[model samples]
Target: MFLNRKVELSLLENLHAEGKPKLILLYGKRRVGKTELLNEFARRHRALYLVARQEAYEGQLKKMSSEIAEFFDDDVLRHSPFQNYDALFIYLAQKETPVLFDEFPYLVEANRDLPSILQEYWDRYFSKKKTFLVLCGSSIAMMESLLGYKSPLYGRRTEQILLEPLKFREACEFFPQLEQEDKVLAYAVLGGTPAYLLEFDYGKPLLENIRDRILQKNTFLYQDTMFVLQQELTEPRVYYSIINSIAKGNTRLGEIMNDTGLEKSKITKYLSVLKDLHIIERRVPVTEKSPESSKKGIYLLKDNYFKFWFRFVFENAEYIEQGRQEKLIGDKISPVLNNFAGFAYEEIVLEYLKSSPGFPDYIFGRWWDKEEEIDVVGLDSSQNRIIFGEVKWKALTEKEARQTLNQLVEKSVEVKWGENLKSGEIQEGPEKKYMLVGKKVGGKKRLLGDGYLVLELDDLVEN
Candidate 1:
């Protein structure tokens, strides 16, 4: 299931090759494969790895003491826990080795003063040494708080790595036989989680994989979200209700609170946790310079599988558990698939547009406070530039696409790219930018005399 982790792999490798004393912090969501990556890295380096267990502070320290004894050929260090970690610090200072602490937050939780202690050791002992100390965790709140300003470890960390899910392009490596359209569909369903992607059977059809590996009775991921919730927080049901509400399109703050029977004030904390977990994202239209200035903040479950499950399957869990997945997919989910795919297609297009060349610096999302919403908008603050784009999953012929382009020309006047453009002269503001993204590209006529850009999934898969 290992696909492309090019960016992360390269960074870690370069850090090691720098031949300096570096402290690396790796943090991300649970089951996003932080440990797996660390293990792979450690194996390559022949490093000493110690995973802090869920035991008392003294017991865990004693376990580490034993490992250090075995690693360094010092039998005396095994009998007792390194008193206050200063002794262990002194031992590690003499060696130029890679030392990793996985699930480090457990050690921190077992002893709140651990970060302060590490800070003292780093400044007094380890900072001048040549060892690479990597602290890894899944709790974003804990990790960020510890390394953030005002925390004990602030300014002491040399580097931080926040691992994300596999991208759409990387997911293609998992199922080579799967077509580009199917890769996009898989990305929508799996949302790039390596754990979820590993469950797929490359030899079988996508729907068959979904039926057996995802919806079956004893599937690992059937209660996956529940386990994640229980491990991370105490009040799982309330958070579940709010997440389910958002998944069902109850996006507004008031709407989510009402649907979940939670107070408005409490909703913020819950939503913040979800955002930190990278399961959901809150977005305001791009017109506003910052989130605070915008009143249009909308929350969405960013995890595609969770969104799909909450939207259709969770509502009919009884039937799903009774082996009605096929019927449910036909009766309830199929119609919504196109609609859902349409939204996902829009997201994919927006994401690509952001990273694509020729985009402006002040790129913002567009919504007209009505049904007219542009999928992506690139705004050039320096040059008063406006680019409009549309993403279509359907097979659009050149004529149909040209009509859509003409429609965009009409909609272009409504968007305020800046004050420089007069009513009839918005096109004169800057070179007009228009894009059409889909499974297949229509001819140049769809460009509407603007700088043309066409993106087809076929081209994406080859790269």
Candidate 2:
């Protein structure tokens, strides 16, 4: 059932081919398939894999000793466990085999000095041997800290990978039987997490899958959002309030503070934590020079499932608990489903444009001001061009497409992006391009003939 991650497998294989002592770090959020990728690689090579659990240090050491003894066929070693982490690593260092320590943070939690012990062993023994050691974890912050300047393991890893979720198109591969539009809807709900995608039943209707698998009390995904928060944050309720506020249309910092009744400072800290977790992100206008410090930065949930949960599931928990799934879906979700999909469709189009042929090298983002907003904006400094686009979820006729195009053109002029870039290297006026992305464009041929980049659902899915 494994899919994608060809590049990751290739990287591991290449590292193994080197036949030298190497320290590799693999980390990401939970359910991102880090363990799956590691298992696949382990199966391909003569490697010993140990998954650390939340247990006493002695228990972990004994379990690992048993696994190692089994792996090496050394009954004597199994009968006599190593005295400490250092002795165990010393024995492993001479074996010249790949040893993967998955969920490494759990081991660290059990023994605070494990990192220092590994560092000492690595410098004295393992570093000189043809050993491939991998330290993997789901705790993003903890895993990243191992490479920070303050950590004992800093500057020790030969390679590191911060694995990300699958892209929209890659996720579509999970449900080949579903239509393109259904695939999009499924992606919007389940996101690109491989584990989540497997929970969906493509044979069933989309709403049925959502109700039975996602919204029902006994299902895995019913409280998944809360579970993720509880695992990562100390104050889950405050974080939930912040996420709920954003889901309820309070994106701005002030708005979130007002809605959540939390102090601005607390909001800032919680927002930073959420951003690090990849559950939320801060967005600024595409044209802004310094996005990090921009005053217009607004927060949004980056995970589609969280966005959907807060909007629909969290908001209507009572109705769902009352076994009113039918009314809830028909009344609350059906009315706003199209509108919600409209926002997700914008993101999908942006992803499409990133791999689209003929699109210049650019930084893609949204653009907005007090007066107007553009759904998609691409700033190609190399080509001295800016692409302005609008996305409509409904089918569009020729006249509607033309009007949308004209409106985009008019808004592009108002922004005067060229003027903003005048101080930079590109002194000339930037060429402007117009694009329309929607479910369907009735007169796509005519629109293409008229020099417009019109993309329909089919075009998006196919490309």
Candidate 3:
């Protein structure tokens, strides 16, 4: 199903609207709906779309020649394929029609010098003509390299889009009728993956859906996480160890090294590659002065599906192998499902704060010093306003929420922001705001009347 892609489709439309020699690069991870979004955009225009295959370079050229021939019904080119990159690009440069090449990296893999060749043709022929060309790929690392300073196609691309998985709010579109709590649980398990969400049967209960869709050996999602890793990594097992180590609460580099028994330098290098692949992320406290050099960074899996899969499926593979799905669900998943949903709840709150925090310009993050930890911290540099928040996946009464807010007020004093405020350079201190989010917060109106930002599940989903 095509859902929550109008923004991306509009972006492609805007680029196409430029009406010049447009070379667009659209790349992201697998099953992120890149192909579907492109196909949707193609429907609006008579774009010549081509998907590359993994074969010999000659075969790649001939296959595209056939596709182009079919597009124009050229009998001569149909009889004889284009000899080189120039001929294919020259032929395409003849028209101003938009063209999309899905999985463009496959062609590059078969032809190692494809980037330089395309660069030469683009500068000489295609750029001079009104040739609209798009190169799409699922290889995050390789596609990103094309934009690097040293790469051949670095400056040639007029537009580039790094598509990502749907956010918590967008992902809920797949389950329209699910209750707020159920929707949150579904999102917690499936994350924001379009392909993975499609595997679930919305009519069934969440547990049943998880059983029939994910636990079954013959299902698409059962082995999908492993397959994606295999396709991306040359050494999936080594990376798997690191991923598992992090899932087990090894947030520090030294902790991961000790757990995986890998050397420090090697782990750091692999972690860098993992970040580039969008599999993991490095986070520092939002209040840190120099974030990159803070020396307090922690690693987190960027994708929720990866986190869920590793926490449950990867750990209990034997349950599926031995046909003990019931036991696994009863003993493993059901027991800790709510606990798992807490993190997803935090994710939803963070994403929601991005647009609704009323900050003109701000950075959002979780904060901790030694003992005190804040679930949500937003700093608005433009107004010198700071918001300290506490989020919970559980329901809270007004009294409990007041206590939480009071505790947050105590911790707010600990957060040192804005050099001028701490040194008494400005008599009036920076504005401090208290916020709270939960699955259900009783007396939300009263809490809002108390001059605090409060949101519950319904408020979050509707927005």
- Against the reference, the lDDT scores of all candidates come to 0.76, 0.86, 0.87
lDDT per residue (tens digit) for residues 68-94 in model 1 = 888877867766558767777777877
Clashing pairs in 2: none
Q: How well does candidate 1 score on lDDT at residue 204?
A: 81
**Candidate 1, pairs of clashing residues:** none
Clashes of each: 0, 0, 0
Q: How would you encode candidate 3's per-residue C-alpha lDDT over 116-211 as one tens digit per residue? A: 989998998888866778899999888998899998999999889999899878888899889999999999999888999898889899889888
Candidate 2 TM-score versus the reference: 0.95
* lDDT tens readout by residue for model 2, 1-463: 6798888889989998998889999998888899999899889897899999999999999999999999999999989998799879878877867999999999999998989999999999888888799999999888988989888999888999988888888898899888878888888888888888899889999899888897798888887778877888898888989999998889999999999999989999999999987789999998887788999899999878888889999889998889998888998988888788888889888888877776758778898887588899998877777778999988999998898898888777656365564222444577767889888998999988988888889888876
The TM-score between candidate 1 and the true structure equals: 0.91
Off by over 4 Å in 1: 73-84, 357-368, 420-428, 444-451
Q: Give the Cα error of residue 362 in candidate 3, in Å.
A: 2.8
- Candidate 2's error at 372, in angstroms? 1.7
